[model samples]
Target: MIRHLVLFKLNEGVAKDDQRALAGAEAFAELGSLIPELREWECGWNTTERDIAYDYAINSLVEDRESLQAYLTHPAHQAAAGQWREFATWVIADIEV
Candidate 1:
């Protein structure tokens, strides 16, 4: 299995507390249901706790590196990728499990 994780930081003045955070979370949470190749999808809001950071986080599971690559190249995902530029920052990592 492979784990794909991403943290997004929205542009200043665009995210008003939890509004954008919630919206983005909801969008990502629906991916597995909407895209069959996505084995799992999870989204979360960043907390103020001293040990936590990042505006929003998402984790997805795929079969392997190839499946992960296919997921990224899939049409549904390609469409969604168009929205990433609107965010101020994005961090991602993919690893085998």
Candidate 2:
């Protein structure tokens, strides 16, 4: 199995409460049902107030690298990512588990 994790930080001058940020986060949360290649999906905004913490995160699981690739390349994922690209920067990790 593959575990795909993402950590997202809102860009400078963008507030967590901003409408664009909220919509982008909501879009990411909805991707689980929209993307067929995801076997599991969990994502949300961070509740903790910490300087080192990211504003949002995604934890997803897929069958294998191919499925992971499919999830990455999926049009729904692209649209959601595009929304985030406007207000945040993110990092990701893919692990075999």
Task: Give the number of the best model, judged by TM-score.
Answer: 2
Error of 1 at 24 (Å): 4.4
Model 1 C-alpha RMSD to native = 2.7
Instruction: Please write out the lDDT profile of model 1 over residues 1-97, one tens digit for every residue.
Output: 9899988776766663545455555556666777766788887766754434677777899888778878888766765555545554788998888
Predicted structure 2, TM vs. truth: 0.96
Worst ten in a row by lDDT for model 1: 16-25
What is the Å distance of residue 55 in model 1 from its true position? 0.5
Q: Per-residue lDDT for 76 in model 1?
A: 62
lDDT of the candidates, in the order given: 0.71, 0.94
Q: With candidate 1 superimposed using the best TM-score fit, by how many Å does residue 22's alpha carbon deviate from the native?
A: 6.1
